[model samples]
Target: MKRFWMAVTLLLTAGVLGACSNLGFNDSSESTASSGTKTATYQTTGTVDSGMYQGVIKNGRYQTSKTRGLATSTNTQSGTYNIKSMENGLLDLAKKQFSTSKYVFQEGQLITEATAENWLGRKSKDNANGLNPASNGKLDEDTRAPIYLQTLLEQDFMTQSGSKLQLGGIAIALGMNEYDYYQKVKYGATYTTHISDAKLVSEGESMAAEIVARLRRLSGVGKNVPILVTLYKNAGSDALVGGTFFRSVLSTSGSDLGKWSTIDQQNETLPTVNNAKPLDSNVSTDFSDFSEQIENFFPTLAGVTAQAHYQDGSLAGLNISINTQFYSETEIMSFTQYVATTAQKYLPDGAKIEITIASTAGTQALITREAGAKGFYTHVFGSY
Candidate 1:
């Protein structure tokens, strides 16, 4: 465990969502998909969000509370895989770089390229676009990619109780997101790939509720549990990489993603030794020009004040009332400040800011959801 954390930090010092598959929200482009430039339609299916996606993490802990009296659990995860999207030309260039390397997850262990191709790698024309050099924008976890943090839970992360694993290690999934800006004129949409770990255990609703009660005591909640979203572009080969702002969604499931279907809508082609581009760090998300959006903007949360009876038959359990309080803020500015000084792990370069207010109990404010809102409505953060 110590070695894993150390390795991640070192590699991270060096550099480094939603709902699909076990990971959630996969944009698998099928054979029927259109060209890299052609516009397309999508459909979706999976778990209904129901605000469960609006989570807040404090000191690296996520306090999860179910809508109704249901099972409570915790999850953590870490793993590695690359989802590259580019133009046909750039993908060809990148393939050469991957030749000597078979996409290693760590020091010397080489994962099967065929396995990666079927699961994480591209196999079709659309999937190939993932490695193409024509990409005008970076991948967006909110859109093109599925939130596989949960998907990889079984392998990447282990469960303590929810779904017990007798031999695997603790699963802890981390969410690091990046947004793209160049599409249409520059390209089309977003692209993404990730690594995660998960550890989950099921508990009585009463116990789950009890945990939620303890979380209420945190001061300045929103200050600690904030999310960052970025807009990056010009990531493709020199021929087509231009500039533009892009948008996507961070969700648990695409089951009800309006008309957005996650399966088989992506460019499935991949880069080979003969066709690939050099992988480089493009735009930085933690820039002063970007902004963030928050969902639950609570000022201070003492926790859910409720009566415990049915949630758990245990007399020791207390009833918790989920008195829903709403806050909206353009927290981009303040959040960026915190990330610059404290969150060196994610926002080492620093990010922009937007003000968002969702809820307030006292000095502690709770932020439910936050993301990078770039476009005509880009600067608009928080729920107004």
Candidate 2:
């Protein structure tokens, strides 16, 4: 596990250094094999350039999923943040259990787009294998059954065997809707029906069991492969942040799922507003102090905000954005230095921190501090 994190840190550091040197961050960097065999390389999905990394094999030409574009088409989430969160969040969780050193990552190849659409659609005479409950001819929230399953995501993990790679494990994420939005008729006003947390989890677990059974019946996926299934409750369209994964189950053998585990993860915007849940006092105080220090230095700045991620009730990462009006290259560099210093002073010690300095024109600088690292990496954009 330590080695896995170290590799990630090195990759991130290399990416930042490469970006600073005028080379594109996502540019391919490959390692050659002494035996003249193809080796793994870092790759990113072309669909979303969000900086999430995947390991590719065979000269970096890993097989692309047949249903490549289905995620955007089938996803019902209205917010782009939620869509990205659902996909990337699953990968983050899977990394904890499936170390990158041993297992290579690949996009899902078994489930086709048609199968995904059918599973997401309402069960009817035509689509008997649909996972969602059949809809009745009613629009009222009281009588109509809310659609529980919003979208399905799958990620495959491969293991190397002397120049060959085979499927070793699979991770699947189910994105469930917290509120069901529907219209009574065409061109009619849409109404939302809230689904309780208890109901969502109950439905998600049942769907997961059936999904495992179906996966076992697939051609490539057999009964013995280990599978991890996670359930995520998506936030509403108006939410400031994405939703969280509440529960997950692992199946190592057979079609049955193993004992479920709770994922105590949450995301909160810093400088709490609207009487949000109280954060850890130390973290909250540190962020408050950090914000104050920045504001004191540059009072004319538009605003300072942060999105903090928590895992198992502890701060895991923070992404801070600083909006300023200054554009001079030297001024931006000085401000970046000061911000990095203030962040080192006031930010929590164990969490990874990233600070982005931006102006009305565009992004001016970026500063990143790895978890438990002593120094920060600062880069001012343009010819600085």
Candidate 2 clashes: the total is 0
Tell me, by lDDT, which candidate is best. 2
lDDT of all predictions: 0.20, 0.71
Model 2 / residue 45 / CA error / Å:
11
TM-score of each: 0.16, 0.82
What residue runs in model 2 are displaced by over 4 Å at the alpha carbon?
A: 1-54, 57-62, 73-77, 275-277
Candidate achieving the largest TM-score? 2
Show the colliding residue pairs in model 2. none
